[model samples]
Target: MLNNSTTLVKGIGNEKAKDLEALGIYTVKDLIEYFPFRYEDYRPKEIQELKHEDRATLIGTVQSESTVRFFGKKKSKLSVRILVGNILLTAVFFNQHYLKPKLVVGETVTLTGKWDQHRLTITVSECKFGVLDSQGYDPVYSVGGNITVKGLKKMISSAMEQYGQIITEILPERFLTSYKLIERKLAIYKLHYPKSFEDAKHARRRMVYEEFLLFQLKMQALRKFHRENSGGTAIRIQKDDVELFISNLPFPLTIAQQRVVKEILRDMESPYRMNRLLQGDVGSGKTVVAAICLYAAVTASFQGALMVPTEILAEQHYHSLKGLLEPMNVTVELLTGSIKGKKRKDILARLQSGQVNVLIGTHALIQDEVVFEHLGLVITDEQHRFGVEQRRTLRNKGQNPDVLFMTATPIPRTLAISIFGDMDVSTIDEMPAGRKPIETYWAQHHMLQRVLGFVEKELKKGRQAYVICPLIEESEKLDVQNAIDVHTQLQQFFTTYQVGLMHGRLHPSEKEAVMKQFSANEVQILVSTTVVEVGVNVPNATIMVIYDAERFGLSQLHQLRGRVGRGDAQSYCILLADPKSDVGKERMKIMTETNDGFELSQRDLELRGPGDFFGSKQSGLPQFKVADMIHDFRALEVARNDAVELVTSEYFWTSPEYKSLVMFLEEEGVLAGEKMD
Candidate 1:
């Protein structure tokens, strides 16, 4: 049945196939499964339902011949008056000269489209050669170049009608019954064209459940596979060394940090490969905890690899770890994309010989040539930036290195399990002592002078200011202003203070130079994009000014704000918003009300939903339909508990019902990272 299916056949010329390949579509199966984002309820409306104020769909017939109006373009717009009983509604079709002939005079037609009451017009869609009858929903695909809703609907209907039967039932019958799952083929069929709302609802529910369950099964399978196959290299560390490392720190470790450290130690001692995730809020002393683990690896006489996302972060970690471990006689080397020539060769050699006890770096560390002499600990800071595959490469650097994944982004508990099922979890929920809350404000354009005045005052007081812009380049589509323009403008505006620019487009050296100058108090006003949102900790910088603050996500804004308030001085974050739109008001409110990144993230999750939760380039978790990481948190928790209970029970991997699920996970293992498909 699958072999004879339409989904198995290609439907394009060679040239068209190449074009489709650009969009990552190769086969008929890809096209058929490319489901619509939403279903538009464009079911034909009754004539009696029509009102002057409300926008309604109205069926009509052309009372007279349609006319075409041609401007500068070759194609003409069809201008026709649609008749709904005695009432005549004016309708216009743009770039559709062919539609004029289709709307025959004195012929009845059904128009299922939006009505403009103010303009007194009806936009026709699905204009069948008949009067209005029963209503039904229609599928609407996400807009692409030249892809019309009508065309998509027709293609989808054709695909389903011809190949729907061939879509194999992967889930076992007993499993379906246990989960109360609807039939796969029936759900897909009804989803595209449901006879009733109840049918649509059922189909939607079934699809959502399937999406969640399949994803869950995949993660569980991977977890089991890794545990069974991979043998971990456990590093035995003396308690005295870890305690001494902790005691030497300038500040005391928070309870959360201590708890996470204990968890790491526990994992290090375990026989199984330790895949643990250490999640904490910004400035939650995660670095100290990581440093302690590194100390443990050094004490155990094994090399450690600390992988970061960016070169700047690598440098920062290098300096930070060097400062902490230099006293303990543990050598730390930094390796990144920026490290080239003799210096790079030296670092690589040192790493290879195990002369460098702890190696901190970016992607450069994961290169095949770089060898580790008994590398027992693999710590990946900011796991969101490095996907599971990326981390796996780093892990494979040593034979089953105990992986410790760290992230500043504190996700909700339930989401953590779904995202990191292959890894054990540890969370640092506390901030170290003397950490002051940044004073946040939602400054409108009208208060720009006030914000500038505050920056000027801070600058005069020998403190630096960070002026953050949303974008690097001006985009006509987006309302957010650019950092380059802001930098140029600020240089002129604040002639007394030195202004520096840093963004993604800048060379790594140039960025480093600017950041160095900013840190040294040479650049009083550092106008930057979100590039410095994470790295470069300058306590001297007390003021943060963000332009078009509404354009940034809540967590991002929080991260940006985190750049300031690192010192003893009272820091302030002025959020510049456009007064015309209430766009950034919620973000501003959240920023002002709390200094807690977790709370702000929760609020952000509530407002923005889970689609862009971990940013566009999705990381750890599989794409979930009904399981919202924030809103549907309860459902996620239930799923997690159910999964855990099942995994712990005799029925986990041994059960017959879970066989297909394990296979699915093994198949999709490469893609499931963090909310990534």
Candidate 2:
């Protein structure tokens, strides 16, 4: 019955059903579960007790006859003087001329609107005849597509009334009893028609918990399935050989790096497949750790593959890894979209023949033509840049290979668990030895002359600088500095120095050429967009000037700042911005105070929210209707723990207590067609 079409609800026909479907409500269950975004409190209050600008309900008797006056075009204003207690208040309604006939001089009426204390006026949004007998709250739905809020509310109420009783509880009985949660049916009813704010709060809590628990249960099930079904080849590498390789490296591993490497190696050696995330700040030596793991797999007579988002990043990894591993007799090859003809064929043939011990490339690595003989370890750099399916495809190329995902973007712990719950997380918290923290400063556009003077000093010292603008071209709507204009300005100002321009609009080869010039000190100043935010590494660059820095998120500012501090020289990041909004100002302030990407990421989540934190692609974070991952993180933690416990139980799938949950998971397609054994 709950699965019946929404047309089954009263007052809903084919057209109405289409409107509801536009809102993602196709079935009766979806209709009832479409919870109100907010509620309007219609509880009457005295004018004296209500604050100015408060949305309040007032009960009063009409002291004056309602007057209607026509205004601009079809607009009309209706006003009436209502007397409550000893006070006379004016009630004004816009475009509600029909109320004039209903407002009798002595009749009592209810008015709800914004209250103006100084004027003793109620800008009435809703006016009704007679006072309410008791307090009431109206649920407000976010409606669209020819469906009014009133219509959605009516449809949802009808659906709940008809099918609420049959909405089975998916949670186990023990959980409900232990958590002291109300029944699912009551919760659904209260969510749509809450008698009080407390009732609404409790109902929302129940729904949030249920949503999180179900999601975590799915994660737990996926983790368990991967561990059991995706058998991993235990890479038999001697500890002495691993130690010898680490000791031979030019740089010693930091304590944090050592710990993370140990965790990754353990996963590789275990019988279960490795599903891990390596999170480190920019220039934190994550690539070195990945190199060690790749070496381990290669030494164990298995091929290794590394995939990145961009061609330049792939080539950069290829050159660095070749330098590091080639001496160890590890045959390394690069496969990118640019590699063509005989070169590409030779690499593919070598990969298939098990001669290419390690292959590095962009999306070309996932192409059907590329095959590996004994692909054992798969590592993806900047994992968030690739879509979920893209990453999965690369992993599928190899048979249950140990997979490690590396990202320089530090995710908050709360988000990591929610988004990457199935994968083991290892964070490199320490920067490499002798690396200097970049000094960050915020400035307004008026201080550009002084900032440029400072940049000139750095250039005079034979150091390079990066000038970043938010836009590639002039935006007619936004009055901000653009890369083209900035590049032209810098070129004119610093005529003696070579200033190379780069933006997303540039071809990949063109961008790579510009980057190479900057890296080789041929370009003393690089004026580019945020394309330099990720993989461009120039240790000689000591100054970073970002115009309209407030337009960028905190995490992005951090990434751009990271490009400079890679060298031993003291680096500085200058933010030229005069933000009009408080959030923008706060972001600039936060960037200047710390270089901790994780800390900045948390603040970014709080300021810009999860949707904008990762720049539109939420990186696979589940969307919850009522549950806010940031605010309701405690609930998420609780749900995750509960899910782990329940999934680990021997009778989770077969027991009668969990039958409803199992059925719900299957019905919702969360189980992915996995059956009970």
Candidate 3:
């Protein structure tokens, strides 16, 4: 089996493996069992079911010879008339002059596609000629780069042909019998080339169970490790101190905010280390919950650190924390890559001397020079932006400071459980009273003038607007409008409006200046990329115009829409999309129909799948081989139960099979030999 694993019959080289690895396939184990994401059935249909306008797969014998017709300077198109008993249909292939010789007249062929008014368009996708008709489901392998549907099908067939019986059964026999799961050998065979729809269904079920079970087992192990090894940082919370801080707040706390603060306080009272995730929508008062935690730490004579994703977010957190905590004489210090000179030195000195009660910054907060004084609480805003190592680095700054990670991106409950398996999650679902949902619209390019007029009207009313483009500059691959070009165009067209440009390429200070000007209403219209997605909140801003809305994922469009509707007045989120494609129309429809982030996220997962939604850059969620995040949710739940049971059982660590699994996990960076410090 080991020998069979390394050698491919067609002989795959390092170059091919490297390309596969780029798509997250690293080992033979990953490739052989890589199941198809979806399937399309290509069974021949009866002539009675065939509509004039509908695309259908039909089986018939050609009655005459094929002929090619060419226009001047254009490649010829091949056309053939076929007869199936009483029905006659024309099969057409475009720009394929060479097909005339291969597909001779009077040959029986199976073709699939829609029939136009007169011509039946040939779909070159996996059609078989002179073969027995198939009447069931067909698998569609998720192909990428150089791997085409035809090529992948061939490779998979070859792999199965060579290593038919050599495949090892990884799961223990006893467990397999107990779960009623099929053998790994049978599962692999049917996954790639199933004999029937029932076989494929069973194969998918077994594979999904295996992936979910393994993933849940890993999380359960981590949870158990934390439960046993995590030494709770017990802080004596002065209820008076907490109440005093809350009382001094300029605005009253929302019920959700109050609930989260209470939960954090309870966690701080525990002797176990606090590993909590705070998830909230935009403007849901997460910053305030964080400040309450900081106050608790300070009142206990300990320090807390807040780390944000970007310098701008760090700055925003700093000011917000300062405004709330400074009144109580708690010193809030700001740190980032941008801070330098004497000011930086002074902040570090104060931090080391325990003068700074709370420090807020970007990744610079993880640097060796940034030492904390009695750091007891570590809070990371937008925790997904930081790597596991980076977050651990900051946490290790103190003796295993209680870690709290926050996210503005709202995820569904099932996703939260699977993704953040190790951390206790707290959600702030309710927005504060007086906040309004951003009225959203989906429009075409032709309506740009009307959208512009609306923006002008808002500006005339002393409000501000944000124009978001997906790209920073022009791209040959993507012809969408960009920030730089849009800025210039707006400046030329809306000559009276103060338009400012900001993107990722700008210097930190430059971006900050542009944001400040926009916040101060110096710039009535801010043209930027998603850089504005996280910062520069202005109550006066009532409009958010996102160009190329189809270019963005639903979650992203939701986040950009969150920029507006933060204030009291009615706000609008205008999504401008080129609605030519079905996907484009569906994406825009989701934006206009729903304001609930959770619903949108689920829809996004269903439409775009988990890969593009979590994205390559941030694959924080465990990649499952067979578990569909949207469809196989029940399997996920079952896996969750099994994981919890295994972890709680005494034999989990003692069992040899689990030991091997643990070692595998450790090597994958999902688990370490010991608990995280």
RMSD of each: 6.1, 3.3, 4.7
lDDT of 3 by residue, 580-664 (tens): 7788789898889988887888888888877677788755667676777678898888888877887788787578766755565
Candidate 2 lDDT over 436-540, as tens digits, reads 889999999999999999999999999999999999999999999999999999999999999999999998889888988888899999999999988877889
Tens-digit per-residue lDDT, 1-677, candidate 1: 43233334434456544544554456655556656566666566665676664445566778878888898858666778877877777877667677777788888776665567777687655466775454456566664555556655665666666677778666667646876778888877777677777877777666665665665555665675566567876577888988988898888888888888898898898777888888888778888888999999889988898998877778888998899998999998888877789998888788788898999998888888788888999988877676668877888888888888888877766566776766688988778877788888887888888888878888889999988887898999887779989999888879988999999998877988888888888888898889888756898999999998888888889889888887789999998987454546767777889988878777887777666777776545565533355645554555565555655567756777777655665566532442221
lDDT of each: 0.75, 0.89, 0.81
Better of 1 and 2 by TM-score: 2
In model 1, the runs with Cα more than 4 Å from the true position are 3-36, 42-132, 141-169, 172-179, 239-252, 307-373, 383-397, 409-421, 470-496, 503-507, 579-594, 599-677
The residue pairs that clash in candidate 2, if any, are none
Candidate No. with top TM-score: 2
Off by over 4 Å in 2: 46-49, 63-90, 95-106, 118-120, 247-252, 318-356, 363-373, 387-397, 432-434, 615-619, 669-677
